[model samples]
Target: MVEADASWRDESLGARVRVALWLRDEVGEGGVFSKASMREAIKGTEQVDRRMRDLRPAGWAILTYRDKPSLQPDQLYLEKIGLPVWRAEHRAAGLRQISAKTRRYVYERDGHMCRRCGISAAEQYADEPGTHARLTLGHVNPHISGGGANAEDLITECARCNETVKHLTGVQMTKEQVWDRMKELPVQGKRQLLAWVKTDFRPLSPAEKVWGMYRQLPAAVREGLEDDLEALMRS
Candidate 1:
């Protein structure tokens, strides 16, 4: 028998453990057990319901289902946490597995703004209540374009802009295209543009990254060398 944690006992852990063990023993390998069977085996409806909730929080039980009894299609089948290797395989595939620290670093690097529209994370929340902040890291070149999951290839963007650019066809645009677009904006628009650009402008290669960094030089520097910057790009 697996040892039950003492702290877990307060949260219907004993009932949950009984349910887990009962399912493990009676249910064949990879076989599905109905909720009704579990309730009967445990001998109480309320106890089974309470124990099922508790088991979920402890990660010991997973609710799966099969469509055998065609008439009553709503019944769920219970399975052990580790019964199917496919469960583990599917989980591994589904999990992005990015660490919290890495996520924070990406956010900090992007200055908490959307790469495409320059919307700050705070603005995104204010504009769309009940939504999370808009600091998502996205790939510069998609995986289809041979981009790997690396810091150099990732940049921050708001969810909307990220989704919009994700469907673009043909060759990926260069950072120069980004800068040229910025030049077309009015003062207020430019300010908003710069804010997002600063946050979401990481390039996929060291050379491109360097170019992007220089492209975002302070407004004062750009003002003094605006003509020169344009001329340099052209030549």
Candidate 2:
């Protein structure tokens, strides 16, 4: 077992490691605390909640009201601390280690785009201009315990979609906002979206598949091909 060599108050350690340290020191096993309190302690850092969720894979047993009905919605119970993440050896405790080959295969298989949103690498979001999407690999089911690092078990996702899919924090869009956008879709678009929703998979169209392939090309080559495609269409 690794002993606590550093204090949670140390700002230099990673956010996840500091969070583990904070929980260990401030909220020991069986201690109860609120999200606000945790955030207040770990000031100036973002995604404290997400960091807490990351500890679960390491064997941290934190529970919310949903898990323990007796607790208030704002309160969390620390059932157990699973790892001594403060130690160098356990720094990556409970995290999946994917092979380089597996990562490349998964990214290529998903067309180097976010499988959930179909946004290619370095593409800006329609709703959020100036924010380019950064792609990453996520488990097909983020909540699954001990999910494997196999290609079949992984999916390409943007950082935003990854956190949202993991239920790590609040989504950018609310239900009402999403419903409003859904209502604006054309009839055919609505039908297609419905089909995709039913299966929880959006099959890439021929054009999208080719677009993914084209996006993988070098920037200069992609620019040349863009002109070529336009010319070919005109021809």
Candidate 3:
């Protein structure tokens, strides 16, 4: 039995714990609730829905409209609760630990850029000017039973793409919208994109690979390199 003091009202609890408690206390099993209501109840909890979704890996059966056609778009059904993450023993449940060696190897292998969107570390999104892309490791095949921490099993991805792909929600652009942009590409560009699509991987050009390395240099060194490159070009 859960303790009486394990209340969702306690602001001190981690957001994940509070979300679990809120579902346990407020919305019992087989209950349906809206994202808005949960967000309202758990004010100040950043990405409350994401915290709730995090429970899924722990065997929490949270059914979204995509999973259950009968549910309204904004509604979610708690089919069953899995682990009691609030408990000390199960606190780290469902979280995978990647070794430092594996992390470094994967990032370097992928050219320190997100394999999904081809965005490098600290590069801002074209659509969202002020927001910079953050890189993270994601499973190459997320639907598989066990997503191991091996280098082959992992791929560098921007944080936005990581969440979106894991959730099976397509990127913000519609297929038609993307196709329209693709149609505008020159013939050579189209051929290059087609090759990338066929392989499901974008091969960085020599210049792009060098640019990724350049982006990692210190500010002073980078400025000096810029001047050297310009002088060499003029010679």
- RMSD each, Å: 15.5, 5.9, 4.6
> Alpha carbon lDDT of residue 232, candidate 2?
100
TM-score of each: 0.33, 0.63, 0.68
Predicted structure 3: clash tally: 0
Candidate closer to the true structure by TM-score (higher is better), 2 or 3: 3
How displaced is residue 121 in candidate 3, in Å? 2.5
User: What residue pairs clash in candidate 3, if any at all?
Assistant: none
lDDT of 2 by residue, 79-148 (tens): 9998888788988877888999998888777878898888987788999999988888999867775678
Q: Single out the weakest 10-residue window by summed lDDT for candidate 1.
A: 85-94
Decide which is better by TM-score, 1 or 3.
3
Candidate 3: list runs displaced more than 4 Å: 1-5, 9-14, 30-50, 63-77, 143-146, 169-201, 215-235
User: lDDT per residue, candidate 3, 1-235, as tens digits?
Assistant: 3354599998888888889999988998999999899999999978897788678778888877767889998898999988888887777676667999999898878888888788887777999999887788988875443357799899998889887776663356788999999999999999998998999778777888777667656668889999999999999
lDDT (Cα, tens digit) per residue for candidate 1, span 102-130: 76677556555555555655343556676
Clashing pairs in 1: 110-199, 114-158, 115-157
- In candidate 2 the C-alpha lDDT for residue 209 amounts to 76
Candidate 2 ranges beyond 4 A from true positions: 5-18, 26-53, 61-80, 87-92, 168-201, 216-221, 231-235
